[model samples]
Target: MDSKIVLITGGSSGIGKAIGIYLTKKGFTVYGTTRNLKKYPDFTEFQLLEMDVREPQSVNRAIDVLLEKENRLDVLVNNAGVGITGPLEETPNKEILNAFDINFIGPLNVIKSVLPQMRRQGSGLIINITSIAGYMGLPYRGIYSATKGALELITESLRMEIKDFGITCTCLAPGDFATNIAAGRYHAPVNNDSPYKESYGKTLNTIDQDVDKGGDPEEVAKKVLQIINTKNPKVHYKVGALLQKFSIVLKKVLPDTWYEQLLLNHSKK
Candidate 1:
């Protein structure tokens, strides 16, 4: 563990930065990627490389730089993502695509760039930081949920496909955590003229409040460390408030309509 090499995307801030800092203190050589290095000129927790997950060439270049220096990448954490919320009908097509590009395709690009090196190492772990919301569709967060939910399914398939190559892939879905996500997410403006004005506006406030009152990001960092130490990790793991994690279970056992109503009631609060 002292010599493990780890790469975490979006490591400049939020959950990614927390994880990188924790791992570095635990004796791991951690490198995190950021879209803009200048924004974090004061970031000293770990080294930050420049990379745009939406661009394959940029992703490759950043990983190449890491590989050339460390010669091995023992872990890859797909923690880079952006949140989007709106009524599907009201959301712009371009915003929807941008959400998927950054939250879904972006991670895929990073994974594709990192896989060859992991394959050569004959041992590696890929942990995707998804969201508990991914397990269900909330009223205004359908697009964000879809992006994370898609990544969860992809991780399931990826694990089996790469098992023979001595590599492992898994998803860790976190519930609301106090972070900069709410500040950075693309929120479709509340249109006073739109039909969803009342409901969408209320739901948007609830979403932001949840994030504001969320748990510390270090909780997620600790979970990542646990996953790294485990010899055989599960296909999916979740860390969040009890009610939030229970929501996934509710979705599984409750009738579809009943679960829908439960979410509706919760959101209205």
Candidate 2:
């Protein structure tokens, strides 16, 4: 058995599940998390552990079990997340809080649970699955961008803090991918009088279309495997189509007006 142990949150589906299956084929021991154990993956090489990233106790118990069984966790992938799409003003406060709690704080909970074990081992990798949205704010999904942006900042600061202990933290900023996010998106109710409803509908539809036609999840899985095999991984990476990846760079150097127009033109806002 490969001695490396990997724990991935939200592995029941989407990018997380893809990563788990891919890594297991490479001989790594992967423990994947699902909110419901009955929904566990059918793969023999992939073990399903019950977990809800929203709960600290669930996070702790799952990590404890993994460490008890493997004695060391070589990697922790914070892959669990949710998305909310609506005009910033129309989006309910409750929904905003939920998005933040799941996308931002959830990763922190998992990190806290796994750190002591990693510190004992003297080396570990914490990969926070953020998004390209984290770098640039999008209309309707502004809060999601905020949550991911927050995690990106956290990852940046965390890298320096734990480097001396042989622990490394990095942000995996994936571009659009074919996933279940479209179905789970929480869209605010459009009141009859809301001025932004027309534009909001158009923008959200464009996003859904992009997601449906986005890059394959296996591509992301391969990139992750490459990161795992390397002795020293970089601080950040973008995995997706060339255009999607290039947008980050273009945003960096473009004039503010040009960058704004590019985003608006693409989303038809």
Candidate 3:
């Protein structure tokens, strides 16, 4: 059998890095792409490339480089993303655009670039790292949830479209992995004279507390590996503790009004 070749975006750190390491250890050739090469050095089993998912040219160039080195590509993991947190009214236009670009458009760019190769090979996998926010709306994460929701829809459509081509698409929806995502949350510009100054501080504090309780990134990575090896990968795989499992069930069982009220109540506390 030919060795598996996997390409991962945003693999410099967090869940992406953990996935790269795990796959490499499992004997797959791992190619990792990141915008910050200086921050992430090359690893033993993984080759690092400079690529920004937000830029089509960068994504295409990186794909060309990989194709030139290896004639066949087996897997593409679209893990590059960003988060924006603030009241919708306070969030800037640029921040919202960036979140959508990185979270939703970025994956589409990668899929467009790599789909031809996978189609030719007649077998491959595309893993999308989505959040539970994709399914359940959360307070102060309107923009982020919107982006993930878009991804979820895309993943569903692609799964049916690509099945005929012998390619599989899996959307891995993790609840809250303990990752740097929280630290990297985008903050809206504040004016000292602004009326929302006091509320902004409280919002930031709430974000900090939520992030501190996020699940372990390594555990999420393990789930990614399992999905890759599973005979029948699920359209959506939820990872985390009981709370996360409950949330997913509730989203399906409860009415929208009740769900919204529950989220609003949690946010206030």
Which residue pairs show collisions in model 1?
A: none
Candidate 2 colliding pairs = none
Instruction: Give the true-structure RMSD of model 1.
Output: 0.9
- Between the candidate structures 1 and 2, which one is better when assessed by lDDT? 1
| TM-scores vs. true structure, each candidate | 0.98, 0.96, 0.92
Q: Is candidate 1 or candidate 2 better by TM-score?
A: 1
Tens digits of per-residue lDDT for model 2 on 139-215?
77899999999999999899998898899898888999999987777988666798987887788789989999998
- Model 2 alpha-carbon drift over 4 Å, by segment: 41-45
**Highest lDDT: which candidate?**
1
lDDT of 2 at 23: 91
- Compare the candidates by TM-score and give the number of the best one: 1
Runs off by more than 4 Å, candidate 3: 41-45, 189-200
Q: How high is the CA lDDT of each candidate model? A: 0.94, 0.88, 0.85
> For every model in order, what is the number of clashing pairs?
0, 0, 1
**Ten residues in sequence with the least summed lDDT for candidate 2:** 38-47
